[model samples]
Every structure is written in structure tokens, then in C-alpha cells.
Target: MDPVPLLQALIRCPSVTPADAGALSVLEAALQPLGFACTRLRFGPEGEEVENLFARRGTGSPHLCFAGHTDVVPPGDLASWTADPFAAEIRDGLVMGRGATDMKGGIAAWIAAIASLPRDLPGSLSLLITGDEEGPSVDGTVKVLSWMAENGQIPDVCVVGEPTSRAVLGDTIKIGRRGSLNAAITLHGVQGHAAYPQRADNPVHRLVRVLHRLTAQPLDSGSEWFEPSTLQVTSVDVGNPATNVIPGTARAKLNIRFNDLHSSTSLIALLRAALDAEEARYELDTVCSGESFLTSPGPFVDALVAATRAEAGVTPKLDTGGGTSDARFITRYCPVAELGAVGATMHKADESTPVEELRALARLYAGVIRRLTAG
Candidate 1:
């Protein structure tokens, strides 16, 4: 199968976060040509549209699911690119586009891989393509997973086609991702004249103590497969124009990238305790996305490593170090792992993937499928 043409066709669509831009249609067209029955599902609040696709082939046991997104991040500063970001230019043997390495290429590879399978393949195969992975992500995979559960379409294993390869095309396959929690805290203080410092409760001083306490100590020494937990103060915004007046409120936002050493609840508890020590009137809100998960290098991960060695001539490292992806949502349903092409330039001005590697990925994925269904 010609994977380049399919990759080019996918990259040509400017489906930047939360937009379809004909990306899914291109995929459906390819899958339908290969005998996969397609279904388009949309779920979100009234007046909001979130597009998703669930396609399946064969009718038997041992179902295998492939999941990914068609959305690309914004092509920053179009002038910096050698060619148009969505033109899908093939220059110097590299396929250049916004989503070239991050994903469009991976989806194309999987399509080609399944196309190469026998026409009467055993077991079942499916695809879960979402359009909201790079956005707030409320309406894409989460909704589709629910729909699958309600409709009794959950698969036995899931392979997320995220760009997990680091230095090479098959150097790493991620078994899990560290969870992310973002929070904003506001400490209330008294607005008093600067001349009378003793009368006013200074929120800045209180918040400084709180932040220092939070950051002074490390969250952990580090887990086996994960790095040490980290919490960074992203922003401390007072928005106060007058320096002479003590502000009524001091606000700050922190971004925490934590590992399996701590749970979201435990971190929240620590935050509350810190606030209690400060005795400051404060309020906080937290958003948690996927606590750390591990698949334990079981049969699913072993198959992936074997396929990479056979097809790509390299042994892949089982990793859990990266920002969160849709794998977080898939982990709830079954054992899931992420393996794909080299992501040297995913969401940049001149994102690219070599043409040769794209074909190699197709072969690698085909081998994975064969190994999965051989038994």
C-alpha cells in the first residue's frame, strides 16, 4: 500500500484543535476501501460540536483497538515554514506539515498496516479517531469511550498511535503517562494604605510563604520508570497597577507534573495543609488528567517490543515519561500502549517525518497486527 499518498492526503487538511477539516473523512475513505465499517459519533453539550469516529473490521473475538487524533496544533508564524503548513510538501525526502510527525503520519501507517492484512483476517480490529485531543479534550475520547461502553464495543486491548518514538522510529513505546494537575490559588487580603503596614493583612507575604513551602521540598525522590515529581509556579498575577496600595487579592497558578509516587488526592491534601499552616483565607481549584498508570510489561507490551525488533531492527524501551495523551482515557478500558514514528518536530513551524520512516512504520504496524492475531 502507498502510505505516503495517504499521509499527504491527511496532512493537507488543516484540522487544528476541535476542528474536523475533512481529516476524519479522509481516514474513513481509506478504511472503507479496506472493508472497515465506519460510524461517526458526535457528543457534547448543546450547541457545541465534537466529532469522533469509531470504525471496525472483522467479526470475531480478541478485539484490538487503535486510537488517535486527527487534530494538529496551530502552525505558529507561517513565515518561518519552508512551505505552507498544510500543503503537505515533500522536500528533501521529508513529509513536512503541522501534523506530519505528531500524528497524521501514524494514522496513515496504521491504515496501510491493516490494509496489508489478509482480506479474511481473524478476530476484530477497530479505530477510535478523535478531533479534540489537543484542545480542552472534554468531548473527544471521553465521550467515545462512554459510547463504546454503553454499546458493548469495548476492545480487549488498545494501541494508541501517538508519536512515542524518541531518537528513532521504534526506540520507545510508552506504557503509561504521568498525570497532570493545574491549579489556581487566590489569597484574600486587606486593601490598606501603604503608609499603615501594621493594619493590613498582606496576601502577597502569605502567598509567598505558601509558594515557598510548596516548592522548597521535593515531591519525591523518583519512581522506577518515572522521573522525580515537579511543581512549577507558572504565574503569580496581582494585576495591581498602583504599588502604593495593598491589593485585596493575590493570585497564582501552579502546574504540577507528578509521577506515581503521589496521587492527586494526596497532592491536594498537601496543598490544604500548607494553607492551614499559613492561616490565610484562600480558595483553589484543581483539574486532574489521568493519574500515573503502568501496564507491567505484560503480553501487550511484549508484543510491541517483538514487532519493533522484527520490523524496525531495534528494541523499544518501555517508558512512562511524557505529557498526558488520550492514552490516559484508554487505560481505563484495557491495557494500552503508545508506539509510533519519530516525533522530532510535532507542533512546530516545519514539522516533518522522513518518507522512508513512514513506510517503515507501516511495515512495523503490520507486523504488530500479525503477531497479535497469530495465536
Candidate 2:
């Protein structure tokens, strides 16, 4: 049940994003021998299939669910890596690979912790794992949770094993996360020769004005447990190749990380109003990844803090800073928090984590389970 070997086995799978690549099967083999009943859930349309797993050891109240993903982002430019991205190479006291820290390693640590616990000691213990966290996310935890709700398998509390720690293991516990909204705007206009300035309605000018309105002011000062909201214009393109012709359309894309003060609906309305004031014909598309959520400090959070102090000797910060995570989806069902290894190298080329740190994280998770389930 040692996490190192398990993590090595998992890292060997090239399970990037939506591909399973036998990652879940590896986990299943590890869990079945430990008395857990495992269920494989395949969801989404035929073309974009997502594999998920739900496993449980007991059937009673006070169920503590550990949620995570087995998927990793694509290893960009493999030639840039020091070793094979899927080799799970161990050197310099670290395990290097695509998911060493961003998540697969965290999952391995938690499973190892679970293995150390008494099989009959808990009211309930379950794992909700998905392979779509790094993909479009249409067919991952969100679908599995719906299935769990239908089957009456909701847990009392949940812990998401995302890489939330910034500097040291257990130094941070993300009590919540800001919501994410992505918007694409396309402004329509007439195309004309440069000589006919009066005939061509310049859509670029109108688009620039719209972007100015969106970024001119702060979304909010700051929330009680959240940071100030932010909006960034990621791309602006006219796609005009000729110097003599004014483009017919201009498009710009924006991403907003918002706090509790605003919801996606509210922000969309604000954007629409801005476009209306510009008096330009335009098409806008907005996708809300998740809504802002917070699990206020209480018994569950206190237990996590206590466990971290005992196991890692650091007073963990109750933070709401970070990009959106699956915890955003889990918030609708139960109180959830995020705690895991330092994420300094998560999605980078040589993604890695020290073997000692991985062992420490396993111990920390064990302590968390012990504290929460103790009678």
C-alpha cells in the first residue's frame, strides 16, 4: 500500500485528459484487494467518452468521500522533457511525469492512506474519480454525482485532492474557489477598400471600445473569503491579411475569474449592456465553468486544519484563491475543501514531486481520515 509504487504505476499510464489508458484499471486492481466495491461509469456522447469510477468500503452515515481526477493535461513538446513524460522516472529524489503533482500523485497518496485504515472502522468511505477534469468536463464528476444522487450515495463531506498548496505540503487548504466565465465576442461590420473610409464601418473600433468598458473597472474590491474578481482579454483577431481592406468582422475572447459578488448570469447581463451601449451589431457567447462557492469555517474545516498542524507542523491557510477546480461542482452537493502537494510544477514540462513529500502527503491524508472518523 505504499504510495510510491502506486504513484509510479499510475504515472506510467498515458491517460492524458479524456483518455483512460488503463489508469482506472490500475486503481481498481489496487482497491479490489482491499475490500472496496468498485463501479466503472462511462458517460458522455459516443465520440467523447469519459470514464469515471465510484468505489466504497462501507455503507453507513458520516460518509467521507475523497474526490479527484486520474487525468493529466497533455505533455507539451515531449522533446523538452528530461525523461519520458509517462515513464514515472525516479531520480534526484523526485518522481517526474505529467501528473506527478497536478493530480494522479494526490490520488495515489489518498488510496494509500485508505489502505492503512481498518476495513470495518468507518461509517462509509468512497472515492469519486473522473478522467475528464482536464478535458471539456461535460462527462466527468458532474455526471457521476448525478448518478450518485439517483442511487442515494451522497457523502456527508468531501475532500478534493487538487494541488492547492503553494510552497509546502499542507500549507494551504482551499476553502473555496472563484468561479470562471469565458466569453467570445464577434462584431459584424461592412468590408470596404481603404480608400472608401466613409463606406466601411470599422468594427475594430467598436470592439476596442467594448473591451475598454469591460476592463476599465474592477469587478469587486474583495470578498470576505475570496479575492477580487478579474477579467483578461485573451485574444483579439480581425483575420485581415490585406493592408488595403477593412475587415468585415472582429472577434475577441475574454476570461473572468469572479468572486461571490457576481454570478455568471449577472456578468453576462453586464456584458450585454456594454455591447448595447456601443451600438454595434454583435454576437456574444459565454460559457460558465463554475459559480463561486465557499464552505464557511466550521467543524469540517477545523478538523482539516488540526490534522495539518499535527502532521505537517504548519498552520494551514484557509484560502479561496486559485483557478476553478472540480470542488466547484462538488460544492452544490456537500461542503468541500482542497488540500494536496505543492503545485509549483504542475502543468510544466518536467512536472514532478519529491518522493519524501509524497510520503508526507500520504501521512497527512491518513491523519485527516483519522480525525474525521474517530468516534
Candidate 3:
């Protein structure tokens, strides 16, 4: 029931992105003995299969599902670390690895908490874990939720263990998150010599004009429980070999993190109108990761706030400021919130969390499970 060793075992798997690397097997091995019925789910195209796990301890209402992902972003440079990223070494009272904080630790903590509790104490307890969270996410939580719906495994309320704390563990909880939309714009034109000013149609200039139009005004002011929407231009490429010749094609990519004041559809229309105003032939492709959503103050949220205060000795703030997560997908099925450890080192070179903090987080999660399932 000690979360540290289980977390150490999980970090040793090297389960980067879509690769299993024995991560779920480690989890299954731990859960099966604790009376959890584990179901392994493989979803997506033939070659890009994603591994997911749905483990439930009971079948009843008020199902308290703990959602998280074992897949982690790659450790960029091994030389930058004091120890191997996959070694799961404990250095100076810290667990060091790729997902030590952003969330293999969280998963291990929750499982340890569950193990400490009586098996017959709650209505139901479940876990919806996915392996595609750090990747494109085409075959992860979204598909798993759909299958859960068909198979009657939807929980009453869900909590995502997404490393939401800012300065201290359990100091902050994400009640919602901003929506994400990625756009790619490609403009085509005639390629010709620079000296032939009359023959060459410059696409770069047109693309710049379009970008200017998109960035000229603010999307909106800050919304209630959310920050102002933002549009950032990430890249612009021409791929022209020579300076004298005008490139035949120009492409630009941008991302929008929007609040609840707007949806992806409305924003896409706004983008299309801007392109139409330029009267240029271009292709606009957009991918909507998720729509902004908020879980209002209620019994479920109240239970989470109360649990954090009782267990972590802090009145957690209900925040809605972060990038997208699988929580966005869960919001469609039920009210969901996020909580976990301090994330100062997540995705960094020497990612880690304090050993004491990890143990305390397990206790805090135990409190949350008790309060949520006490009905």
C-alpha cells in the first residue's frame, strides 16, 4: 500500500506516449490483488494502438472514478539529469523521473489510498486510465469513455489526477479548463523570379495580412472563473531555397486557448471570414481539442473542497486556468474536477516530487474518496 514503491515501479517502465512498456501490467498486477476487476482496452488504428485500463471494485451508483494517464512526455536530455529518468531513483527525499509529479505519482498515490480503505466502504470505486494523453490523443480517454458508456461504467462524478497544485500539494483544484484549438493555414501562389514583379504573386504577403487580421483584436476579456481567450502564432514557414525567387506556398500555424465565452465552431467562422476578406486562395485546417467547460459549485465540488481542507490543511482554490486534459472529455459525461501534487518539476529535466508530499497526497486522496463515496 505504500505509494512510493508502486510509483517507482511505474516510472521504471519507460511508458512514453503510446508505448505500454509494461506500465499497465504493473498497475494491473497491483490492482488485481486488491479485488479490482481490470479491463485492458486497446483503441485506434492498427499500428497506432493506445493502451487503456478500466478497473472497478464494485457496481453501484455514486461511482467515484479516478482518471489519470500513465504515459509521459519524453525526458528531453538524459545528461541534464543527475540520475537516469527511468531509474526511479530517490535522491534527497524526492522521487525523480519523467512522471513523478505529472502524474504517475498521482496514480500511485490514489491506488495506495484505495488500498488503505475498506473494500466495502463505498458504493463503487473505479479508474479510467489512458496511455495516449501525452500524444495526439486520437485513441485515448475519448474512446474509453464511449466504451464505458456502452458498457454501463459511467461514474457519478470524476476527478482527474493532473498535477493541478501550483505551489503546494492540494492548494489548488481545477474545476474547469480553457478550450484548445489548433489552426494551420496554407496559401498558394505563383512562384517566379523576384525581378519579374508583375508575374510573381507573393503568398507570404497575403499570409502576413491574414495573420495580422486574426491578431489585430482581442478575442474577449476574461470570463467568470476563466481567463481571457488568447491566440498565439506558433510558426510560419515558406521553405524557399533562394531569396530572389518568390515562394509558391506559405504556411502558418497558430493555437487558441479560449474561455467559455466562445466555442471552436464560432472561432472557426471568425477565421474563415478573415480569410474571405483577404480574397486569397488558401486552405484552413482546424483541430479542436476540447471546448471550455466548468463544473458549478455543488455537492460534488463541495466534497472536494472540504476534503482538501481537512486533509491537506489548505482551503483549495477552485481554478479554471490551464491547458486541455482528458478532463475536458469527461466533462461531457459528468461533473469533473482535477487535483494532485505540486507541478513545479513536471516535464522538466529533473522532474520529481518530495517523498513526504507523495505520502501526504495519498492521504488526501483517501479523504476525497471517503467524502465522495460516503453517500
Q: Arrange candidates, best lDDT first.
A: 3, 2, 1
**lDDT tens per residue, model 3, 279-323:** 778999999999999999899999999999999999999999978
Candidate 2 stretches with Cα past 4 Å from truth are none
Cα-based RMSD of the predictions, in order?
1.1, 1.4, 1.5
Clash counts for all predictions: 0, 0, 0
lDDT by residue (tens digit), candidate 2, 199-230: 99989988999999999999889989988999
What overall lDDT, based on C-alpha atoms, would model 2 receive against the true structure?
Answer: 0.93
TM-score of each: 0.98, 0.96, 0.96
Largest TM-score belongs to which candidate? Answer: 1
RMSD of 3: 1.5
Error of 3 at 251 (Å): 1.7
Off by over 4 Å in 3: none
Ranking by TM-score: 1, 2, 3
Clashing pairs in 3: none
lDDT of each: 0.90, 0.93, 0.94
User: Residue 197 lDDT in model 1?
Assistant: 77
